[model samples]
Target: MIHAYRFYIDGEWVEPCVPKTLEVIDPSTEQPAGTIALGSAADVERAVTAARRAFAFFSRTSKAERIDLLKRIVAILKRRNDELGDIISREMGAPLAMARAEQAGIGATHFEQTIKALETFAFDYMQGSTRILREPIGTIGMITPWNWPINQIACKVAPALATGCTMVLKPSEIAPFNAVIFAEIMDEAGVPKGVFNLVQGDGLTVGVELAGHPDVDMVSFTGSTRAGIAVAQAAAPTVKRVHQELGGKSPNIILRSADFSAAVTAGVRRCFGNSGQTCTAPTRMLVPVERMEQASSIAASEAAVLVVGPPSDPRTDLGPVASSAQFDKIQTLIERGIAEGAELIAGGLGRPPHLDAGYYVRPTVFARVTNQMTIAREEIFGPVLSIIGYQSEDEAIAIANDTPYGLAAYIQGDPEEARALAGRLRAGSVRLNSAAWDSAAPFGGYKQSGNGREYGKFGLHEFTEVKGIVGFLND
Candidate 1:
């Protein structure tokens, strides 16, 4: 078993002020995979102090210097890519193939993209007679979720480094091995001492302390909506900037012009991808009422083919959810879907056949679901899909936008009509005809989904504060 009992602070691996530890479980086997030291407020303070001290020089670093640092980090990450994939699979139940292709790959992608963005990004620009400057915000406190662990970490960390900002990261304790490995990568890449720090702990202690720390200029959080509100509240006293990418119950609208078979199949695959734990998953499928039966059949057929097994299995497409708590939550929601009168069209309640142990949940689908139903309204972080029929195109848009979340929306139909309909979506990211996700595009949400954005130029800008210098140049 792997043992990670030290926190990364000030360029060294040091024991926490308090020696509390948490067992890291492999969700697939329900076995203890590893252990990590649980951090305390004192640990958070140490990390914040280190970041504050580093900001003095790091913030003033030239773009070229920061670029080199990012490049080096990317190189080290590439060398350890496969190792990262295996570690993440064991920690969070992501299939090994997915862990390598997306989990680990996205981390490297962020660093590489940020480096290219920095090459042409203008930090200082002129407007009228005044010069506008975008400077790095100091001492960021980042709290990332267990789902998409490395992806969230890299998106935040890569941009912070690119923008020449110092940060203290508190990766989710449930899935922290990848973060620990990443910190080692930073050390190997020769990141300036104290420029980056890691504290492993739960949100109540370390996360709260990091957000409420007076020295932290900003707090970037990616997790559930409830925790995000708490982070915002804690950081409010210090008036630090809070950037959140919270929960999403995104909608997928299949227009009357679309091919139902293809759309429904693709939607099921996308929804179940990551065991349906993605914050922006298209969980609620809005189909034409006239074709409800047809859509349901396709969705059921598509879900039937998914291979649910241990993450280590080469053929497994769906692994167990991240933890016992998550598994329980998904199971409860699936039961609620049934009790609430939604028709069970596919797999339902309990583990897949032959899976006696582990946190596995059956990939479930509910048909004839209404917007008011619990299954359709709430975010079920599992392989569950709720298909709701809509009377008209206008009704579909209304139903899609009814939720508190506006993280993402999907549309399938003729290109022209889909594009036109996509304009009506309240979501931040709208995918048409199952288009490929663009890493360069700004990603976040509208309304309760959370504020601010990440990825590419938008991500780099999130770590910076704008300053307008009036009359600095002679006119």
Candidate 2:
């Protein structure tokens, strides 16, 4: 009944050039929630032109003006936080609590962070006889995924706006209601006409068009490595700047000295947050060989306590996977885990017991999982855990870095030991002793987990290009 079957471009809601549409299904009910107009190459072109026109003057706006704009955006977003959470839960199947606490909350936080960073950030720095100026990169093309809909979109948009860069957004067609609401916030916040635009469609159509558009100066993408590669390739011929946050097969190392019960149980629970669909989930857990049994038992017991049910249910901790395709993909991976001879310590394929309808999946844990196993190497993007055993601390680190991903790594041990292990890991961010997040820290990956960083001043810098003004004083 919610109608979002159009694109928001040039500060107005416009129909797509092509009338292709896709039905969005609520994963909790397995019913059509709404339909979004699918955008095409022409639609992307229209958006790019709009953003390009807006960038000429908007990018030249003074820092103070941009700061005020960001603040206004933050205020508008906060006012509609509850409505945003509701749409996210219905469209993406996140529990209402998580939608409120993390999904919508992180979006507002990112905006606030951008505003704060802009206040102290130096756009022009004196360098001896010359000055180095950090200028806005021209129109950006942002392609965000479904798992953390607003989190990714806001992270990109807030920084782009703070840096005085205009942009066109292509949120995942699977869970796009949050984005629709976000477009409304931008409009309400008095963003200049054409400074922000939205085009909804699958990756093949709108995604490819946006990445390949010559007018688009940069493409900031968050999705699977496979898709990231495609976006990079598409933009390669144009030689545009490509920033990616790709797939992650993160490792959670539970040292023998750490409290096994507490660490294992807590780790499993956190990994399953967001239905275990997070890109940086601790899907690969490495434990000492002797402690494998204990870790597995604790993880399985903890997973049992997770309530997988409707997103609207206040008691449900884990909601349904975002879509039917995701549901099928998860089941196939779980079956692959069983076929590869890994012990299904707790759950297997299909929905959790007592949940007959919905695209729900059982919270599964697999033990004795080798690094070479299908589930261990692949990004499952489901509420599934794989426990791999190692003999020594060095061996554990090796197994942890064995994957193609290096997004995030977890270490549990004495503070000193954890810090030491964290340094050795090939990941961008390491959570030592289960530390809380630092908003100002740089976040990115080393290898295939994708390039470039987000959060704090690092994210603001990503949206800008630096130029040296040599000998202008002589003029």
Candidate 3:
């Protein structure tokens, strides 16, 4: 069903209001992967109406039922895992291995995490002779980004379902087929009709309509800060709750107490992972002024070894940015880094010499960068790292918290001291000594990175409305 160019609305594959389609480009080859039926305002209205109609019954479901439903979803995801990975690789240009394991695999992880959260969650309890209820916030409008496409979709979709909230999803048009397959999975998992809907279109049409619609109770968006702001403004008139996880230029602080080689290597590796498309990537690395040269050398070495090839290459460590627009933006930033006098220790302009075509970017390292530099300030969503020098711990902390984005930050130092320093940083998530990612932990931003958390139990809460029955509940 998903193979066709159709929207999954009201639990059926339906044709668009007007038969318009958009081509999905595979960045690795700059070739057409496929096309999706582009939706309009009318489609958003149809999807939202369906979601609103279903919310009443779905919200009343027991937690156990939702847990079972999430379990089924997880099982189907795992069964079709590699298949979905192939789709992601084709559309987004992630190396097949990373695409399979991290990209497609993360979807199952989100569902498993949602099931765990749903199992232990307390939907209602009595306090002071009053019953406090956490009810579903009906009809959610979710707009997700192309980078880490499934990660955004599952994190939002799983939680909304776990909380019994119906939703209309506007996945990034750049890599939309994964969402089509995802909707198919929901159908196979026996998810009720109208409980979840998928609309294929750009942000201007489907996204804006969903956000501004009177029936949609909340808007959840994951994308650039500029786009996130637009979603908020559009949702304002309806007074719908808006949850956004926007852009980030997350800092990775390599403290004086740590091993310079080890810290710098790890920072570069993390930054370059996913071809540096991660929003929470350590784009800016802050090191002591004395160790700048060492950090620069280590970072350059890491960048040198990274294989920037076609996503089809098994040995490829980094793949192309999602589109030509992304390639141009990253190229401009690399040029700016050189022009601004930041020492370009590794990678400058253009694609790798070996690769004749494709949007592959040279893994770049810019040293002697100051916080004021555009390379340091901007969220260049590519495998580019900027090494900024800091004189003292206070300066490092200051520099780390200086960005408008507070999505995540990293500290490579003693666990205890990093813990202390982590608190001082204004980011929502701070990893210590390259700590592992915790799915249960609350994940969101402190400021303009956007509002609300979306992970485990924290994510489930975001889809709920709190109500108190004071007089009716007499204990």
Candidate 4:
């Protein structure tokens, strides 16, 4: 078993102030995969100090120099890609193929995109003779969730580094091995001392400390809305800039013009991908009332064929949920959906047949689900889909916008119609006819789904401060 008892601080791995440790579990096997030291407030203080000291120099770094650093990191990450994928699959229960392709692949993609963004980005601009300057936002405190551990880490860290900001990161304790490997990548890439620091621990001690630390200039968090609120509250006293990418109950609207079979089937696979642990997953599917039965049938058939097994298995399409607690929560929600009168179309209530050794959950889909149902409104973060019927295009749009979240929404129809419908949705990102995800597009939510965008130039701007120098360029 891998034992990681030291925290990365000021470009070095050092013992935590309080020598306590937490066991890291492999959710698929339900066993201890490794151990990581639990950091304390003292460790946060040390990390913050280092970041603060580094910010004085790092924030003033030339754009070209920062681009070089990012390029180097991208190269190293590519070389260690396979190893990173294996660790993520073990730590978070993502299938081996997915772990290699999307999971670890996205991490490298973020850095490479950031490098390209840096090359053409205009850090300074002129507006009506006033020189506008966008400078680094100073020391940042970042808290990322376990669902997309490395993806979140790279999105945050790459931008911070490219924009010349020092940071202290607290990756989710549940799945931190990938973050540990990423820190090593930073070191090997010759990241300057004290520019990037990592402290592993829970939200109460380390997270609170990092968020509330007076020295930190900004706090970027990605997790549940509840946790995001807590982080904002903690950072209130200091009035630091808080950027959150929180939870979502995203909708996948199947318009009448779309191919019903293909739309519903693809929606199920997308919802069940990564065991539905994604924050912006399209968990709620809206279809025409008359076609609800047909849509539900397609979703059920697609879910039924999904292979649920150990993440290491190449053929496994759906692996176990990340932890036992997650499994229990999904099961409870599935039961609640039944109690609320929704039809159980596919899997539900327990582990898949003959699979009782892990935190495996059967791929479940519910039909005739009302918007008021708990399963339809709440973010389940599991392989569960709720099919809600809408009578008209107006009703579908209204139902999609009913939720408190506006993270993401999907539209499946003719290209023109899909684009038109996508424009009406109250979501930050909308997919048209299973469109591929864009790394350059800005990503974030409009309402309770959280604020501030990440990815490409938008992500780089999150770690920057804008200033208008008026008198310097007198009219």
Clashes of each: 0, 0, 0, 0
- TM-score of each prediction: 0.99, 0.98, 0.98, 0.99
Where is model 3 more than 4 Å wrong at Cα? 1-3, 472-475
Q: Candidates sorted by lDDT, descending order?
A: 1, 4, 2, 3
Those runs of model 1 whose alpha carbons end farther than 4 Å from true positions after fitting are: none
Residue 222's lDDT in candidate 4 = 96
RMSD of each: 0.8, 1.1, 1.3, 0.9
Candidate 1 residue-wise lDDT, 355-467, digit = tens: 99988887898999999999887889999999999998999999999999999999999999999999999999999999998888889999888999999999999999999
Cα lDDT of model 2 by residue, 107-148, tens digit = 889988888888999999888779999999999999999999
Residues 1-475, candidate 3: write the lDDT tens digits. 1344788889898888888888788898998887788899999999998999999899888888888999999999999999999989989999999999999999999889888888889888888778899999888999999999999999999999999999999999999999988999999999999999999999988889988999999999999999989899899999999999999999999988898899999999999998899999999999999999889888998899989897888989998989999999999999998998999999889999999888999999999999998998889999999999999999999999988899999999887788888889999898999888898899899888988999999999999999999876553
**Model 4's lDDT to the true fold?**
0.93
- Model 3, residue 417: C-alpha shift (Å): 1.2
Which residue pairs overlap in candidate 2's backbone? none
lDDT of 1 at 291: 93
Name model 2 segments beyond 4 Å from true: 472-475
Candidate 1 clashing pairs, residues 3+ apart or interchain? none
